[model samples]
Target: MLVEFRPHARLRGKQPADLGASVLPVVAAVSASDTDLGKVRVVCDWVQYRNNFRDVVQLRPILNGDLEIAVDVRRAADAPVGELTSALLRQSPDRVYLEDWRPGRDSCVWRFNALYWSALDLWEKATGRGYEQALPGGESDARNRAAAAELIGELFAVWDRLAASAALPDELYVIELGVGNGGQAKVFLDEFRDLDRHRGTAYYSRLRYLMCDYSAHVLDLARETVAEHTERVSSFVLDATRPRTSLGFLRYKAFLVYISNVYDNLPTDEVAQLGGRTYCVHNRACLPGEEAAELAESVSATVDELPALVHKLLRLGPVLLAEACPDHFADTDAAVRFWQDTWAALRLAERYVPLAGLDTYPLTDTLTGEALRPLLESGADVRMHVSNGAVASFVDTLGLLHPFGKLVCHDIFVDDIQGYRTTFRGPGKYDGSVVNWVNGPLLAHVGRKRGFDVDYAPFRHRAGGHVVTMTAQVRD
Candidate 1:
């Protein structure tokens, strides 16, 4: 078996080579070439590696058929080396195999994520609640009327100046991306109309409010919520990562593009710098062998058939999946239950593979891995999300802004390089979608390169909240 050791941010003042030598004996028993375990990876700091989410000693059936043993450096430093062997033996498996390995960007996790939104209505009915109820506070901060009013005030300030020069366009535009249940759009429109009436301005009469989201089901719900302003609102089903494809007509015309709780859900890849070498993290989705057996039996199927069934569920959704595989699923409810169960049982196996060069890494379509060296090599050892989808959307959306226009987003952001070292940034499950904190400093860097000023501040409306407000505008 091939042994790879990755020391994380929590591992301080220790060399990767030293850590590898200390744990060599602990992994020797499972390293036989003929053994069922395909590869071995020893992680020095499991807590920091997994962001303190799971409390476990080892993760089996990881990428490329690897067995991962996680060690607590502090404890291992003091205890007898044999204790590490004991923990490893306790979690060692009888046999290990999985369908395939993939990068985090190519994992089945995203398919499941899209399924959640496409079949959201059915999921809500089966679960007896909406997706928003699964959030921390059972609601999004984006719906705040006060926050809407604040943004509207800023738009008014810009419009007032433009109006003075007789340059205000005949039609005023305000675009909202990721219109979750239309709550934010309703609040903004209501505030705009009220504020416009109060100020005795005709801006409301010239307003064109556009709501965009990836889910048609979500857009339908949003339309109902904001039915009072139907004349001013228009909704589109568009991919958040490539908004320019759908809204190219509005290039350099949109005065405001607002987003909330959206960027964190986009797909991202992580890169790590270890022992003076850079590597890209690749992931494979797996269920523990025993758990796989139990789940398969629960669905009236064998463990060998789980992967194909899962792919079917993701491609056809639970309702059609029930019809497609009547042998495994009695009906839609059964398939929905299977989907939920598999998601809860889902675990990712990750490996660090050496990169040929940083330049070869594509951070996004317009940016490359060369941009990440500054952040990756800033400290001892670190792993950080590249936020590929968010960066692509940010760059494309910038094209939608007028010279004086602004883009505002509120989401989880890692504002400082130190934040990655100290906190769990995510890859956490939020409902059925994925959430990873966007790289704020990197985005600010890219925006500056494109002649725009980007700034990040804590969400002002909610004190001590995790949300950060990022605003970008053409640099004066």
Candidate 2:
């Protein structure tokens, strides 16, 4: 879809003029080729001034192929062109997916986006692929299903805590920033039903959850799933970084936000701007061998040029900051060496001098509480706990453990008590399996590093699989 904004020539000025006497003209256009695409054009009709108001006119065309709008303005001739341009640009029309389209004024754009992404995720899962394989370790349905169950359990637990605190709003509207699918929402709904029964009131009506995602296909699946539960759940298609343009209502309404499994895809500044009482989750994987090799090579080459390249780019400075090396893989030193060697090989082929003395961590141990304690102690809040789950043996064992696990209790902590069963499809095979990376190492690291109380529970589904859910709270 294409969108553009243009302001009429009449509203440019240096000194403030009476906006009430001025009329501003604006134009917006959007185009789309997809049959399922839905678009909305919002044109602010009036620019409110300190003393009075200005009428902003809007023109809409009827044909569905493309949208072109024009507005007439009669404003002060000395008005700032930048200000005028900014106002018009803010209202640009864009093609939005059907999942993100809200028919009335009461639309939840964020929810629609979440649902849209979730639907696409489901399709990817159903199809056994994704746009890109960014993480190491092959994808598996068992892993995704187990992860979904764990995520749902976490959401329910959070809701319970909020409810118990008695500080929750009478009407809770939750917007999960990166809700991949309705899996977590489903868990929330189930928990809400139980909470309703316990509280002896229709708590469901007071609660609304929305999922926002970037993909329309995913939102469709999320919408379908949410519809099966209750109308309170909805989906929206949105880009997280530019949510304001799509989810203007969020600025006026208060909501508890959840961002999970999506932070790695965003930059730090963008993450900081996502305001709200938010629960954020991030997962990082070890880089694949090839990518790691490339990284090491680049670093080595920079070092060889020495004082110039390293000092200019790699050194810590006001204008430039060195990029942190990816914290994946078993041997940090070996990974660095691979890069250095690759660089040396390149230099030798070109008959250039080699550079040495690049320091690298030789430790083979997996990242532990001790290693990460410095980061935690540096006064950085632990937004979310980190975990790794690529161990083949642990994954295989989880499949075995799933069959016997009983769904004992599920609230803040999903507890399933049962014995182990063997369901591992073997190496390279994708099946739903849960392992120690989630339950053991991750829980341990968070608990020890952040001095947080942690709880681990096993959930057994009648369908036969074990999923472990863990919760942690940082120390006061």
- Model 1 CA deviation exceeding 4 Å by range: 1-55, 59-99
Assess every candidate by TM-score.
0.86, 0.30
- For candidate 1, report its TM-score: 0.86
Name the best candidate (by TM-score).
1
- Relative to the unseen true structure, what is the C-alpha lDDT of residue 89 in candidate 1, on a scale of 0 to 100? 57
Residue 109 lDDT in model 2? 20
Task: Tell me how far the alpha carbon of residue 33 in candidate 1 is from the true structure, in angstroms, after superposition.
Answer: 16
lDDT of 1 by residue, 1-476 (tens): 44444335544555432464346555664553334554455554433332222323445433334455654453455555445455445555422234476567777788878888888988888889898887668888898888999999999999999999999999888889999898889889999999999999889999999999999999999999999999988989998999999999999999999999889888888887766778788877777678788889999988888888888888899989999999999999999999988877777766677788999988888788988988998977677999888999999999999898999999989999877765556687866777788999888988998999999998999777688999999999
Per-residue C-alpha lDDT of model 2 across residues 1-476, encoded as one tens digit per residue:
22222222223566433333332322111222222124333222122121111113332322233232322222333444234444434553221111121111112222222322333343245446653232233321223444444544554455566668875457655565555445656665666566567767555677767777666665665577667665787677776555545555544342334443332232210000011111211111122234334544555533223323222322322122233333222243433333223222221000011112112211112332233233223332222122222111112112221111211112111121100010111011011111111213333343444344445654343233333434333344
Residue 470 of model 1, lDDT score: 99
Which prediction has the highest lDDT against the true structure?
1
